[model samples]
Target: MASAAATSVMGSVIGKLAAMLTEKYKLAKDVERGIRFLQEELRSMDAVLQMLAEKDDDQIDPRAKDWRSKDGGIAEEIRELKNLVSEQSERGKRYYDINQCLTASAQPVLLDPRAPALFQEASDLVGIDAPREEIIRLLKCEEKQHKVVSIYGIGGQGKTTLAMEVYHKITEAFDCRAFVSVSQTPDMKRLLRDILSQISKSDFDQSQMLETVEQLIRTVKECLKDKRIITTTRKKAVANKCCTGIAAQMYEAKPLSDEDSQRLFFTRLFFSGDDCHPDLRKVSDDILKKCCGLPLAIISIAGLLANRSKTVEVWSNVLTSISAAVEKDSPIDKMKRILLLSYFDLPHHLKSCLLYLSVFPEDYSIDCRQLILLWVAEGLIPGQDRESMEQLGRSYLNELINRSLVQPTKVGADGTTVKQCRVHDVILEFIVSKAVEDKLCYHMEW
Candidate 1:
């Protein structure tokens, strides 16, 4: 536990060092170089501590202890630390082959990739159809004049999903269209480049040739002529900036209605309340009452319950867990408590798979194939054969999607497979915190 706490502290220091290297800090080249040096050293120290923590006293070499005690000469201490680092490296290579751990029969069946799309459509959105229509009308895609609209709201209000629904509905009306999520730390060059790549006619990577932000923006402006664009952000100020000097409108996202909330809640668990067991109705209602009409909150709780047996005893236990875990706190804390229930319920392998996603930046769309390859490379996937490994990876992803832990973004050419996906900002935030606490990933806020 002490070593784990040390690892957590080291993660924080490493994150701070990373922030110092960013352009915002304006760190000098030499100072930046020095910080990088310390970064490497601290990381090595972190690994040594973790390796030692996993060992029994009798298993630890006396020389390592002497070095830790500062009883050895400088040269001796350096030599011992290097040896420990080497040992740690070797230990890391000892991957737990998941393929050997469980038989193929034990694996859960893969969820249909299309299952996640149930909530993506306007009709499936339950309460937000009016907002979707209003935003589309606001775009005025039929008009020759280009127009901009921004959907602004708190995280988890479905701002991105609402904007995306509108984009899919009206996208064909325009000659060219592109949708990109602007990260908090906006990489202007990359942002402009992504926009061009999406909407540009030519196959060539147009943004690659342009080195400066100005050139990319100029090229983007040239391509965006007479195009309808919609932007979503948490802050109204940022939304207004996205609308700067354009015919623009701002729409605030609202929570799901009581009736719609119940509909969405049941849709996740049973797809309809008629299918729900009579005994569990009261507990389900109590859970939704706690959720308070937040769509993400509803999906999360419903996902957690979907796999469990439909019984009052089981449902009541989950309700009690949520109540016991959270007080009459702020909505954010309540949401976290709900997410915590889902996270804790996951099997060990899925926990690692979910936490791996914290490496991606917020609002980033992740490719399913690429993510699967990453899981295999990280030794997170295990199977007797290569085919099974890939199959298992997809199953893991589908399970998360079905549980509403991950959001499916793009469908494949076949129209049934979820080819691309992204984590909701609220879920991403929660995952990052858990990742940092477990030392599974490192993150820093500037």
Candidate 2:
């Protein structure tokens, strides 16, 4: 009995020691990983600081460079020491959290060819090109003060596209310019930051919305007193409020004219280098009329046509099919119906993300960072085992933006930057209505 008790005690002691060693091994590995990640991040930060220093050479004298170099060397040494301490103490939990926070805090970088190749290819395929002439005309009109040109039309009438085209055209003429989307569920702070950030060509902290707005307004008044500012809003009331002192001209974008519709249809259907079988126009025109000159409707129908034979009868039948699918309400309603078809076709997770976007008001432009943060906060995005919530949120937003439901309104002056998003008013209305219909959100009537 004495021998058995001694054996058991020895076994327990050995097990405890093994467990301690195993924990230490894990700590060591985590510390190593944390150190490597930290080192890489530090290197990137150093490169950025160096670039900034180079840009502000006059502010940083020759002596400052030597000081900076020494400072960087000290930082590296400190990091190494911290890594050692992390390995020895608390099983690297602190280091893991630090690494996580670092990753979460980093802003998303928008890489070029930012959207999916399929979207770019689709844009190229249909030649649903921007109208430069109309854009220039709008810009020139915006240069004249007291000119309120309302591009008024029902939803899906391409108002946002026309507005964007005008914005890009006139951007060079303005010293400072801002574009904001005021949706049904307006987040004024985010809208302000997005506009201010665009004009300043920098990342304005969303938390500093009031300060950013004040600075932005001051900059606009001083530098672009005569420059044009363009904003889109679904609510006339909201637009009226925001545009009181800022917008020089408000052009309400209308649906395409019958002639424009026919032209757009022909361009989409037959303008491809391939020859259209003469019957294409007869069928294309019928599809175009069924779309009621709404760009989205036209485009959706055209997309359907692009996949099939380009006969007039086939085109007419396509229109009949679309009409059968859509309920009669307004041109905007038809457009929504068409857009819904596309939305329904999306995978489950993407559908959830897209609907979550309805929380913003019409024409409300969303910063990519802000959108991702909101998604994370809402718990709509899934947490990754290895990646931070922010990273996962970014990936989700990028996926939605790529699908073309979200339009990129502004890209920063930095060649590589996150693009601000704006859903078309028609799209926003559809989302909001869907949200209300499903009792997912309460609509506040103004």
Candidate 3:
């Protein structure tokens, strides 16, 4: 009996030992898996830390610190970790949304079906109050049968607005229509790509410049073979006009008419929707004469007047400042110096590009594609070490347009492409004078 009892005890003890060994092995595996998961999570956190460091340098507040500070129990800690992930995801989404909004807003014109027209007859186009018959006559004279008629002028002188007005008026007569703003320095390849992309409504490899250009020209020729096209530029080159099959007729868009100037001045001075001040009108007429009908000058003077007390004395003071500036040299020269104040405010890279524009001839309508290519060639745009040169160039162009230093003359029908650009004659002349002053260009005597 004693022997049998001892055997049973030994069996029980062996079974217990086996169970303990299995349990210990299972625990070890669970611990190993947990360690691996924690290691992966730590690596993810390290990546987030690196991103946070970059954001900190940019002056953005880091949210990781807040997450680290949250207190939780064992189960709560796991939940909090999940919440942290969700929070980071939300933050990334917000950042993307903000970036997109900024990009959309920074563009000169964002084309949307719901967006308002470029010109609000009363609010946008200054000096457009002339008799409808006279205005239509001028536009009709600008019309061409088989060629593209480009109206060139200084920036902010209503070139695009005028073109928009004409486009809205005459688009019905053509089979197809396109409006493009060529704001960047002229590049044949980029221009072709833009034309093709807009026409086809598809993305393309812009790096394939030659192929893109050929494709664009072929597409444009095919599509607009019978359509009347209007393009604009700020670079004085006959080459751009000849690229497409259409013959190009150039129109030097003069400044606003004197009557239009007077209207613009008064509108700016007494913008409170009140009755007109005849005295202010008289003063504004004098200011208009000083403006020499340049819409940009008129607008600038008007902007100055709008910020001050609406009194003849204030207008007189503004006129005196302008007159003093004018007495220094030609109105165009004075305008350049005045406009330089705005240029001085640009970032360094943009300043270089703006100055580089002086290489082109006076009253030249610039092709955006060619301009960007030239910038890339000049090393004005940084390469992949930063943003790609093309992106930087485009950003520079956008900045100039936003500052009203460069104006869009033609926007492609697709609404995203800028076909041509024209600096205001006043601004162009200013650029030329600056170039001469800096000895960047020489005037050769024949």
Candidate 4:
């Protein structure tokens, strides 16, 4: 039985190799040579193994038995060949890695949905009057001192839009001003040089590369010692770090209010909320509730619905698909991609901890102690001892909160530590989808 199984496996592998050589796949010369060598070796082994399987034990020669034995023979040769294949594979990966490194060093194209909104006309924006005023008030541009305002919030909540709006409004007050968007994996030298180019006059040559980030920062600061700046980010640490040694204000961007959400949703689909059809109003409100006032989500879904039939059946089906975490559609998939920017930025362990929140129902206030214990049991949180594990788990939780991916519902008596938290429904849906898609966790609905 063992010899027959080995013969069958070898034959199957040889067939695959034969197919590969005949297929349209473009193979490198070395790889094609290796595949031919493996094909011949495997074909020979398959024939020998088949003959050995057909023969009785007494009829088999001792040499053939030796070849089948584990000590050294055909099995040993196969093992050595496997090791050789692995080594070649590793070499190929290393070659690709070098090319990837070169690609990484080049300027990355910005594909972020929010990046273009920085240049959007203020007239095209909705629900900005209040937050815009608040941020501008925090800036206190009238003061002689250079002030920095950092706006932060959950992804898709319009932090970038608000900052850009305020920047345009008060930019004239300062002689030298620049609006730069920092990415998750920022190129510091390029970023600093960008700032310098924006604020510096024509004397600033964009062609000359700066030697170092620190030198660029000194040059930028020297150029803008009296300039006011507005910054926006999702991570609180980033906000705080950028505001260091400067008079700074941290403004958390708020979701559009219900009225504004309706306005935005309808304005994208129709002339205004008043123009919404009677049949679509209820479904629109339902969709808005699921959106949770997220401007990007609202606009995306509304834009999708605008192109399709505006019937209750179609709209309701869309909402139902969202509830079911169905990403087969384009708009929802795009929104998931956009909102998952925060999730993609997380470290591996924090990502696991964040996805585990999908186990809870949406808007469920999770107890910190219970969540930490579960995380430890699931091997999501790593540490040596129970106390240390729990401590580490809490830190992971705090990091997620700091990134604006999770929300704190209850705090400890010290008023600093988060004791309970909840994941927003919009975020939870994507987390559940991601968790299931990656096979990291099984999501079972009750």
Question: In model 4, what lDDT does residue 437 have?
Answer: 92
Each model's TM-score, in the order given?
A: 0.68, 0.47, 0.45, 0.48
Q: Local distance difference test, per candidate?
A: 0.77, 0.57, 0.56, 0.69
Rank all candidate structures by their TM-score, best first, as comma-separated numbers.
Answer: 1, 4, 2, 3
How does residue 197 of candidate 4 score in lDDT? 74
Best by lDDT: 1
- Candidate 3 global CA lDDT score: 0.56
Instruction: For residue 312, give model 4's deviation from the true position in Å.
Output: 1.3
Off by over 4 Å in 2: 1-150, 193-224, 231-252, 266-274, 304-317, 325-328, 341-423, 435-446
Q: Give residue 301's lDDT in candidate 1 (0 to 100).
A: 88
Model 4 regions more than 4 Å off: 1-120, 202-210, 326-446
Residues 1-446 of candidate 1 have per-residue lDDT tens digits of 45555565566666666655655444446877987897799788878877876877688799876544442243344445455544543443342224234453476556644347555567777787798899988888556876889889877778888888887887767666778877667787767777777777472275677678888777888777777778888899999898889888988888788788888887777777788878877888888878867888888888888778888998899899988877686666788889999999999999999999999998788999899989998889865457877888988998888788998878777665678998988899899989999999788655
lDDT of 4 by residue, 1-446 (tens): 66654664565556656655653433556878989998997887777787877878789789877666532345545555555655655566676667557635644222222222222458767899889999878877665877788887777787866877788898776676777766444677777777767777552584255577677777777776666677777778888987898888888778789999998777766656777789898888878876777776776566446546889998898787665653443443546754554466577988888888878864567998899899999989654469867877777776666444665656656555666777755678788889999898796533
Position 134, candidate 2: lDDT: 49
lDDT of 2 by residue, 348-433 (tens): 76677788887776656688888877777676765543246777676666555544466665655763344687776666777778
Best TM-score goes to which candidate?
1
